[model samples]
Target: MQKPLLVTDFLDRARRYYGDHEAVVATTGERFTYDEFGERADGFAAALAERGIEKGDRVGVLDPNTHYHLEAAYGAMQLGAVHTPLNYRLTPDDFEYILSDAGVDAVFADYEYAEKIEAVRDDVPTEVFVTNDADAVEGDWESFDEAIETDAGFERPEMAEDDVITINYTSGTTGDPKGVCRTHRTETLHAYLVALHLDISDDDVYLWTLPMFHVNGWGHIYAVTGMGAKHVCTRGIDAGGIFEAVAAEDVSYLCGAPTVLNLLVDYYGDHGDVPTTGDNDVRVATAGSAPPEAVIRAVEDDFGWYLSHVYGATETGPLITTSDARRFFDDGSSARFGVKKRQGIGFLGTEVRVVDEDGNDVPQDDATLGEIVVRGNQVMDRYWNKPEETEIAFSDRIEGYYHTGDLATVDSDGMIAIRDRKKDIIISGGENISTIELEDTLYEHDAVADAAVIPAPSDEWGETPKAFIVPASGDPEAPGTTEEEIVDFTREHLASYKVVRRVEFVESLPTTATGKVQKYELRQEEWDDEDRMVGEG
Candidate 1:
């Protein structure tokens, strides 16, 4: 007999087999077993049902990497409601847009970030508001602790594998943020691939350094939980806290972006004698952007932990390719860093290809630049409420495959390495920042006449936004705006990560004969000292 692949089965299996095992190590030092976690999720589901949240309702979870996020996500999923997670780093305006766009019925916010949601409560369509601490918030919010203490009950809704259960919002590249709808089968199969590729097991102690809001923690929320692994929760990213957690909890596995690895490397450089691992063998997976080979070398040799580099976007599973191919390099050899530096091979059952504009495969000569496209079971079904955008995303330059908008090259071994970005998106500190948005924001300032934003090489962030501006006065020397002022203006309007860190005053922006701004020239000028415009590797 065949079985339907549902995301709820992950938690159910853990509760059935590992009920007595410790499942969560909360940031406050509290521990909860699988049985206790399941009960809390059930209680949350019951409360949602009481609040008129039906099977197709959208539930928003705004929290960090705390146990509350896991509880809220699973709780909504159990009731067949869409699990929508919001980035805690976003501003109140962004929150308003996402909440209104997704039509979120109810929201469960962490005490620290509930105020942001409360600021936009009157603007959104959400009816029920809940937070971990009702007293800390100055709104009509329900306390999560009290809500789960009731005798109310909820029933599981019969769901098909193709029913959309989650909606992850993209970081508004060209316009308003688009919700990427994912179904139960896509999530479940992605978890299985993650488990198989990352070598996750029940005995492994997984650390929560990556934010659970990022592609559902890049699907680790299901992969690790389904494996019955121990989750070591964290409030935020701290180098000292990370090392301490590894030592204290005996963490065996974790995942992060290249920014996290840079932090660890810099921290180790300052404190050379810090502990890097615990009793179990440590395996770290990195995505978002490729890490420099030097960083990868230091991680493997100095930190004594294995690093696997993966790649994908939010539209895909956020992990369609990995660099963990052990056959390419011998164990403990220096050549492995070069192999791992590439995005490497596609995951099993995932078809990743470097294609030209004509929808034909590029040669595997490792020098031909082509756009990376992918087709997999883990890819999203469609964009929420945007059929035109969905059609363009899947049909642009190819048919039935998600266009990553990332340029890469394939070696003779079919391993792909990213070279440049096709989209006007700057990936600073592993967060996507749309250059068009920054340019638009700059145009709002009275001192700026013309502006173009590009990715500049950042040693710490891997990539930082650099803006070239033409003064309204038509004189570059006496521009009305200061570099610091432009940066401050962006911080006030946009998210912190999307702020432009570097600014250059110019008399005229490089433009084509047709009067269009030539951003490629600006990028080349900004990244002249770097190996590639994309990232270090």
Candidate 2:
């Protein structure tokens, strides 16, 4: 009765009960049922073992959102190996750093990205190189197609629930990306939490719009698979492709960041309209940032999809809180958008709180700012190979809680809304101006879209809010709204003290692959010449 929880059990459950169920709709036009997918994973594991890859070996997977990446994850973890997924957005140098840092014993890369891996193969001590396209592969690499056909004769290795199973790298905002080590227990609990909150079921047809490399697609790969839902993979995010997949596959649920949703909204508005006749009852789970209330409204009224806003980071096992106020919103209240905008209280098996510097709970008035702290089974235990950071990440003003490094406030209803990242909070003169607040206001303007705010070096005010906006048209050639017009629009909504002083109408904001705008990059450029970068609070 006391079986150790392992991620491979998700596939095992599917294979045993739902073997005939269609599991993966690969981008390469390949379809596999649960039985077939499991065989492929077994073969992949067998091939790795054949190459002398043992349990506890770190297997790196460098590819986009595809069935290959998914299969590679299960294959590595099936043999009790740690699967390290590399971000494709990062350069070859980043790859070199991550592959070397994770001590990757084997790597399975996509055909298109084989060169990036080949460039860093010499630097990294990886023994096995497996690629989808064997023609492009150099350095005695194994072909993925040929390897999966070989029946792996090895039995499933023993695994503990607390065993480190996956090593996910952080966004690397300040310096090198740190690996967040997640255990089998943490990942299993996270999958269950996500599935429970999202109400993911066997009937749902999940779309792979989000990158598979990012926190294992925010743990959907496990949750969806365990539920026996169909996975329709899209190699890249394009509005047309998304609609086509939804129509063709009858997609029921998908997840993405606010940026991805914004792109879909703009694409629909500019190019054509979303397919109205299709069976498109879409439910999108958005994180990465607090999306504007207007964006939430557009998703529901304009795009005809239900949107749920969740919040967490790589350290917190990713799904900490959610705003699943469906029953409350169903009454046709005007405040639904406002309610949907807030990142609601802790998910099941998680505890979240907004606390001040002394770790005491902040007043529930919703204006008082503090760090969002969490304690849950979903939170990761340590950062891989970084004991100091591991100690610091769990250094709670409150004992036994993990400090989220995100500035937030708790409303009267216990909804936890994120105001800004700790480093991203702009201190103008002596006032704390949340960049998120300004950006949310910018989203209210019909013409302005995909906005980010940062602190600018101000001669008198120490620092002031500046805006980088992407037009709603999503066309670089089209001229965006004027700075004065934007400033005037903000003055109507926000107080003068919190109002943005300058506006830079850029074609797009620099964003992480996960759809989070890299505000630090813009902030550094803005304060490059200034003696002091951040303002004194």
Candidate 3:
């Protein structure tokens, strides 16, 4: 009676067990059942087969978080074709690089992002183009909806657990972005790990706060669907819209980055009387940035939502570690709540260790600094079409482990605390300034909505810390928020070298597709004239 472990098998099971259960709710007030979802996925699979899509073909999807995206992703998996979700916000050149890099054979895009594909369609080798909107269709493009109107369902391809299912492109902080190919085996296991950590169940109504393009939407698309849980899709991250959806859709669980959590807390503070449909509390799982202790405490105390923190990168299936305070904080003390802000221990299926330069494990005393390395089934299969880079990534400077390029320390209690990115640490005036540390302190300020700390060149010091801020609600154009105020805030909490030397107010911090603040981009402008790419770590 054991069922197959493939993603398609999960979809079919959901259809049978929860056939009449609602699956996806769109912002436009449209809803689909598990049965309807399976039918649409099957229809799309047949449509792709009709268009000559076969096993191993690379199909790129460029769309926002929509019901169609889920259908297309599962459909491609059914055909054994690799589903590559492109970030719709990428520039034209970035899109061109990825399309050509992956050698995508077909592209399924939303009408809003069709123009980006059209601009580089000739440069890339994509042959077939499918768009969601008929009115925006251009030359040689087919209607995505019309193509799937046929009643016949395509036969599921014979797929092994190890077959590659998705290719996720890295954010490319240093140079060109690398395509990280993930196998079905890894994806399936990662989903289980996430679901187990978050305690997902059939009654949980999950929301799509994270983009589907980012690590398979933190793998909830499979984990939630595998449990036959309902998915509430949000078109975008608007404060009012998310609140309304959470209450109206009866959302019980959601995953987001620290930025998303910050926005939610800000929204709830400004607009009181937000209502929830059910008695069960909403649980939020956040990552991407190490959330400030203040934000974590606020989400738990003010909003009355249970909060969990996790840490991982794109190459690690993005769920290698989680911080579950409940297991350790049974005493329910405020100090235990503060400990929840740490990245915590590795997930069940992963092995994490802090190693020195010689690849030796660091002491568990919590003071010894070392690189956080990981090995797991969730690790990416390889960098697509780049064997040399793949080898470098897997077996480069560190030997067997996949170098996370992040610095951390493990406490005696086995909790892992992230210090900073290997490249984000600044050495100025013979002292080290962790940009992450400085930024975390700055975020505790009441007026700061978001903060990014980068290294700026200085005449006296090799490099100094510079803070870029997004004001919480104050007017940037009018007279508000002096640099001295922020400097004073940082000084009260940090050492002299760690204090921000320069401050620039901006509307928003530049973020990667996965919601990580792209600190390298900010450092680029400062280090443009410098000879070296970066100072010694």
Candidate 4:
């Protein structure tokens, strides 16, 4: 009854009980059983151990929603090595910073993103480079297919529940990226919570619409695998492909951000007669931002799939609250969409509170805005190599609670709705875009004097970055730079998703009495017509 909780146990249990069952449906039109998957993982672990990798070493994985990512992750975890996943959407510089900061020893990159890692290979500490397709990459990388063919075996080191097993780097706000260190206990509990709330089972078929790098696919990597569920992999998100896959593979469950829902809704509107589901009933979970009531209605009514809205941050297991409280609303009534729009009660064993600046819980009046804070076993233990930042994150406005920096209001029924973001970051299409990084990039331009970035409403993406610029010529009518030029400049420097979509030139920016730029003024003006202060809802 007191056995230590470890992430490796998930795969081990699945291998023992579900070895004969189908474990994965690869994007390459191939299927594998649990026994084959386990054998490949063990071979990969053997290869790493032969290459001098040991326990506590960082092993990086850079891939899309593919079976290779799952294999690489479990293989790293099997040898008690830290599994570090990198976002595929990030640029070469972002990868450089993350790989260097994490001190990754060995890395497995997909062929499509291998060139980015190759661009900064010398700068990072990574030694053993592996890719899915060595023929497609430019670097001298080992092939994943050959690497997993080794017949040798590796000895798994004994690990405790408190040992760090993973390091997920956060999207930096105003500074360098911070690695959120998670232990075996936190991951195991979070997986249990996800499986309970999402209702995953052995017969369920899971679609990898969500990226595996996103907080370990919102902890579904463990939850689904531990339950012996079938995984259907996809390389990228496409509305037509998702529909086709669901109908073909009989997908029962999936998760995505609100932007993915919008894409599906738009596709369904155009192709009215397209098949939405197969023989099995489908249930979807959406998060990252609140969806519009109309979108939620379209997903439930037109698509005929149940939608659950959840909320959390990368540091909080990315799933602390869910809006699936069936007791509060009748599914037959139109009022159910309103309840689903709020980030409902906290998950079991998780304490979610909206507190004021003085570390006191705010009244459940549904009008007073307060920062959302969370305390749970699934929360991160600390930030890697950054003691000061770690202390500030948990100690800000309260002790032992991770400050979410999201301002929200709690209703009388304990349902919380986000009103605004206290931080200067934009969540565009579920990707975090730092305004400071964009501003710094813009300042590098000769025609720009001062710039302020904020989130703007978008029907497609929940939010997009909008920049307000002060021209060096001190003239709003005839700024030295063009909006297209500013947007193009950001595209050249930052990642594709972080590019500025809207730009307005001004004579001078609105500043406070102390000469600090007032970004709230820009945000208020931009979101004046919206019902909520933040994006989407």
Candidate 5:
């Protein structure tokens, strides 16, 4: 009974016992049972194997939330190959860098995003390019449907527990992205933790609101499939589409960022109302920065769907703490929203602590700021091809804990509240924007003398990046770099979401004696009288 923990075990269970259960609902108006999904997954693996996919080969998946994406994940893992997820929101340069860096042997992309891969396909090391729509793709690529339709048998390879399963790239402190390597053991344990904390069961129907590329949808693919729950996959995040899915599929649970919640709340304000009991007891888990208390209230009170706020990063399996307030407080009380706002205790098997600079515990006075650190089976193994970053992440001053780079405070009731992000990261619309990357891009402009980037409050997005620029001592606004010019330069170099929203021309940036930019000074000025700190909450 002491076999190596493999991720395929979850899908195996579903195929073996829950063969007749409705497993997947695709946006293409097709449905499949557990047995059918498993057979399709094996077919995908067999197709890739025929095209020279072998153990340890890196496979990249670039698609929106779809049943095909889930099949790609399980298929890649089943063959002992590392499944690498590429962010479709990134620019062509980013795609090239990640694909080339990860040594991706093959890539499976959707129609809308496959063209990005085409932009950099010549330079990358990818051997096979497969797309969901072969007709839509202009270049040489294989058809996903044709591959899965084959009957070639797939041989399950022997994989160890510590074998790398997924490579999730993140915009870390450095200007370039870092690939966080997650092992089969890490994913298996993280899925179990998700099942326990989210209370997932076979009876629940999960709607695909979150992107499948994000930490493998926070590891719900394995957990939901293992439970034999039905999956309703969506292509996009429009409010109308979400409501339709909720009503059509009887969706019981889903996850998204505060931005998604804002859309739903805004849509209901104009169109009509949100259905709660008509479908199922809809429960939602929101992450990528906290949601405003008003939105939390609207989801719980107005719509009747329970809201739970969880917090974590790509390195920590993206799920460490949750704020299911009703479990600890009154259910229908007015103060429930306030209690639900706090990032509650760590999930099962996860160890979370807020500590000061010296690695000492911060007092639970609810006012002191400390960095949140985590250590558990759900944590990542290392950063691929970056030994220094891996060493720094594991060799935290606190020892045995991965630093989250988020500042928060714990209350007396053991509820944690985030105050600021220490990593200079802007979680705008659930996407991480690295300020260092933005500043480095600004430095490329000749008219820019110095620059600093910080998060600014936004109503729609959780937060947006605001750049403080010191022009190269020319005309204040006439000759040198105008705000428009700087913005244009950033758009050409960086992704659309990472572009600076607001630009301010400053005389001089506040700097330390060692010539370090004091970003906190700008942060304090920006968030002077904001209601909620990060983005909305």
Candidate 6:
């Protein structure tokens, strides 16, 4: 007899086999066992059903990484309701667009984000509003605690593997966000892949640094939970908070974007104790922007943490490629690890290819750049409520494969190096500017903390490169670098055309909830009121 592979299977397994295991350690210092976690999830499922939520209905959750958020997510899935994790950091307008686009039925918001939800609640036809903290609630929202206090469990809905389980909206830097619908099959496969890549075990103590709303917290919720690993939840991102959690919880694994890693590296270098707890190395998996080679080295060599790089999008379940260079490079030299930092190759169930404009596979020569395309179990079902957009997203330029809109090159060793986004590539006076290449070089500088390059409007060259920088060790009141100094730094490393012509010093770059620098927003500000740079034919 073939057992059905569903997310509920994981929940049931954990409850039955690992019932006594610690499932969640809340930010409030409360703990729950696997049995208690499963019961709470089931109780929430019943509660959701009482509010008229049924199979295939879209339920949105807007909260940080918390125990309630995890329970709400699993509960919605169990009841066959599509879990749409709202980016809590998004503006009200962004929320309006997403809620209207997804046709969300009910929203489970944290007390902190109740205001944002209330602001956009009128625009959305959402029936039920559930908030985590009762005292912090607004706009007639029900308490999440009260809802889940009932011990009754709802009957698990009959769901096929291909049924839509989640609708993750892309961070709308370019335009109105598109909801990427992922099925149970894709989610299950993604969890398995992540578990395999991270080498998760029952003994592993996984901490939640990445927000659960972001690609199901990089799919760790399922991966770690399935392995019956201890989950340590963080309320927010603070250097002291992370340090305290790591030491107190004895965290074995955590995932973050490059921005998170940079913050940790900086924090640990300044204040953290060295030689992490007797061979129990804290392993960090980061994606989004690739970490600079220096950051990677500092994390592993200086901090004694094993850092792995992964590359994927929200639509692809966000676990496509993992850099497992330790297997290929036994020497563990800085150079060998540096090679692994360039995105690397696809995961077990994924196949990646670099294709030219005509969709022909590009050669494995390091210099030949092409568009990155991927196909795998984790590929999203479609963009919800946007068929034309979904069609364009899947086969817009690549014919059959889902076009990543990312430019990359394959090395002789079959490793893939992400060059830049196709839209983010800067062309000035017929010279192409690789923003990623430029950003990588700029990040290597001691003064620069983070950098993003975008094409600025130019009267002479048609378009010029503009660099937005966040300094490493500078007073916010005094950045200490002129435009000429930054331009000179770029000139020393890159060619004249690729050098940053405009420089903007800011405390921080605009980022997505997942910590990706929103370069599209920067481009929009630079090209606003000009129709010439819209990439029209």
Superposed Cα deviation of residue 158, candidate 1 (Å): 0.9
Score every model by TM-score: 0.82, 0.96, 0.95, 0.81, 0.80, 0.96
Which is the better candidate, 1 or 6, if ranked by TM-score? 6
Task: Write down the TM-score for model 3.
Answer: 0.95
TM-score of 1: 0.82
TM-score of 6: 0.96
Model 2, position 52, has a per-residue lDDT of 87
Instruction: Please report, in order, the local distance difference test score of every candidate based on alpha carbons.
Output: 0.88, 0.86, 0.83, 0.88, 0.84, 0.84
In the order shown, what is each candidate's alpha-carbon RMSD?
10.7, 1.8, 2.0, 10.8, 11.1, 1.9
Clashing pairs in 5: 462-535
Model 4 residue 282 CA deviation (Å) reads 0.6
Tell me the TM-score of model 2.
0.96
| Residue-pair clashes, model 4 | 0
- What lDDT tens digits, residue by residue, belong to model 3 across residues 1-537? 844456666687789899999988865688999999888888888899888899899999987898889999988889999999989889889989999999898889988888888888889989989888858766668887788898766877788877888999988887798999898888988888988998999999998888998888888889989899998887768877777777777788988788888778788878887663345579888887678877877777777788888888889988888778566775346875656777898999699888888888889988777888889988888888889987877765477678888888888888888888888888888887788788888877867888898888887887888898888765555325789998988898987768898998888778876678888788887789988756543
Clashes of 1: 0
Per-residue lDDT over 134-160 for candidate 4, one digit per residue giving the tens place of the 0 to 100 score: 999997899999998887889999999
How do the residues 1-537 of candidate 6 rate in per-residue lDDT, one tens digit apiece? 865668777777788889998899988889999999988888889999988999999999988899988899999999999999989898888888888888899989899888987997888878888998867766788888889987666787788998889999887777788899998899999999988987999889888889899888888888888888888988768766776677777888888888887887888778757434333568888888788887788777876678888899987888788777666675466676666577898999688889898888889998888998889998888988789977887786576578888899888878898998988888888777799989988887777888899888887887888888888755535666677888898899987778888888878899987889998888888888798554321
Global local distance difference test of model 4: 0.88
Runs of candidate 6 exceeding 4 Å displacement? 151-153, 272-279, 473-477, 534-537
C-alpha lDDT of candidate 1 relative to the true structure: 0.88
In every candidate, how many clashes are there? 0, 0, 0, 0, 1, 0
- With candidate 2 superimposed using the best TM-score fit, by how many Å does residue 263's alpha carbon deviate from the native? 1.3
